[model samples]
Target: MTVVEADGSFVEPFVTKNLYINSGETYSVLVKADQNSSRNYWITTNAIKAHHDFVQAPPPISDRVIVLLNTQNLINGYPHWSGNNRSLSLPHTPYLIALKYNVTEAFDQNPPPDTNDIESYDIYDVSENKNAISSNSIYRIGFNTTVDFILQNANTVKPNHSETHTWHMHGQEFWILGYGSGKFDKVHDTKSYNLINPIMRNTVPLYPYGWTALRFRADNPGVWLFHCHIEFHFYMGMGIVFEAGLEKVGTLPTSIMGCGKTKDMIRP
Candidate 1:
């Protein structure tokens, strides 16, 4: 069961205990302790299969291309998941946020491309290598710039198999403009966009073989992560970072700056 405003102004009305909250979907349901306090209650979750498979193939793997600013200059490409190319590994040092006093490197002040102008494609078509996993690419933007992002899902290596990805933005809530199946026709889809009363959420799900478009302002300062909430997919490199508003960001806590270049700096 998902909770909405009392007047049902924003989202559609729905009530059910056994709800399938898709990836990129958020729910806030109020639960009252109406039962006995001493009794134990169990809430369970199980994975449901949308299609049957006769033979299980190995998990898909591929290399990721991380773009710093513009799509023209590709920064780096590394192995995304467990494969012969490069097995995925956790970074020893984490760059959570940059300190205002310590940061010296300047980021691009340009805004992201308009979503209406971008083309949407399936995973297979986008990757062109049949590898579902990709690199943790980042799209840097300036402060207060409006960004429209389109999340498109594609078919898996196994034919007729596609999965849902629940994308979550770290710093800001975005308006979910629209969702649709098949190739996302920008012209037709834009007509259906909900300009008013669209659902504003931090997480939104991209349906299997479908697309979801969202609009948000890059007002928050810092390097914010935007990734799929699914653990395995996240491990497989289904994520990206949005480095925004570096020009106005403040210093981060000294304790959290123990790693990276800040490690050598004297703590205050």
Candidate 2:
């Protein structure tokens, strides 16, 4: 298949034998069936993505660059997924209204760590639970600031087991910089990023024991969720919230407010 577009945006045509598409992610590909007419042919599909098969460019230098690690761990004998040591739980309050009206008590503004301590924490260790912290914090980003995020996949609590994660962002579509296997080397991996024709995508996949690099601008105003598209994964706490320039979003109508703390706003 030859991919002509990705995530609703046109990209340099990418030809591949097997391609993986995640939820909220769209791709257009062309297939040529030139096989034997008398023989049966089957196209094989897998979870593997072509890492070095395209030429692309990321946005200009980001104001802030961060690397985050996601892991599936056992907490109190139950399974939960976390990003940067923080397991996310959806809050009842409307984060958009909270940020707009200075409702500090509505959500925690302490963001998750940018990166995990990979040196002390073994990426291959599954012997016991290592990270399990519950949080409903909203990561704040400056308006119009360019951001680069590197999502690193890690081992779960099961022996030799790691699952794939599909990360979907709200409010902004990002450029896929590159993909890498094994531990992500900041210095070496940064050198391998595609800065000529990077594909713009709202959702991207992360393979087990691998990493995916993405870049986007925080131009939107309001609260947006960045999470695994997998329903179960997100339900089990695999997501994070971002608040970007809420002041620029202006006041919210009663339609999207009054959930938790929007009652205090002066409404018409």
Candidate 3:
């Protein structure tokens, strides 16, 4: 197939047999079905990958760089996925309501660290990870600030291997700068970023024992979610919350109320 567009935007055409279409992702491709017209051909929509060629997106520069460690450990005796050594324990109150109402008590302020603290962690090692903790944390970003995010995939507690995950972000699209295998070397890897025409996407895949880099501008208002798109993985706590420019936002629609503290805002 000759690929032409990604996520609804046209790209410099490229050819490949395997394609990694992450969740919330769309592509337009041209397949030459000239071969074997006598029999039906099977089309693969599963995940693999091919780098894109063009898109109007943020340059490969950012005001801040946040490295997120993707790992798993036993949280309360069950295997759980986590980011930056913390599994997200969301509060009953939707984060948008909590942030808008200044309800400090509604959610924990524990934001996932921007960097991984585990020194010399082996990506292939299947040993038990003991440093993880669960919390109702969320991240606050300065509106319009550009951020470069690097995802480092790591080993888990029970499985003798790491797993690939499809990461999705709400409220904004990001420029996928590049992807790498093994531990990410900030100094060396930064040079490989595609500054010319990196594609814009809301979701991308993190290869097992590999890394994926993305850059986005937090120009949107309100709270957004950044998480593993896999249903089971997200349920296992592989995600984080983001809030930016809330002061600029006006009253949310009344339809958004009636949960947690918002119940009071929606009276009879």
lDDT of each: 0.55, 0.82, 0.84
lDDT tens digits, residue span 134-225, model 3? 87888889999998889999887755688989999999899998998888888888899898778889999999989999999998988998
- How displaced is residue 35 in candidate 3, in Å? 10
* Best-fitting candidate, scored by lDDT: 3
Weakest 10 consecutive residues of candidate 2 by summed lDDT? 47-56
How well is each residue in 1-268 modelled by candidate 1, as lDDT tens digits? 4565343345565666786656556665656668998999877887675433432221121121121111110114433321211222333344343325434332222332323222433333323443322232345676777677767565544556667778888998777778888766757876888775677789998887777877777778877877778887667656666677876766556677665556665555
Candidate 3: give the clashing pairs: none
> What's every prediction's RMSD, in angstroms?
15.1, 9.0, 8.7
Tens-digit per-residue lDDT, 57-159, candidate 2: 5666778877778888666668899888788987778777666667888877777777777656667767355658788986778898989888988788776
Against the correct fold, how does model 1 do in TM-score? Answer: 0.57
TM-scores, all models, native as reference? 0.57, 0.76, 0.77
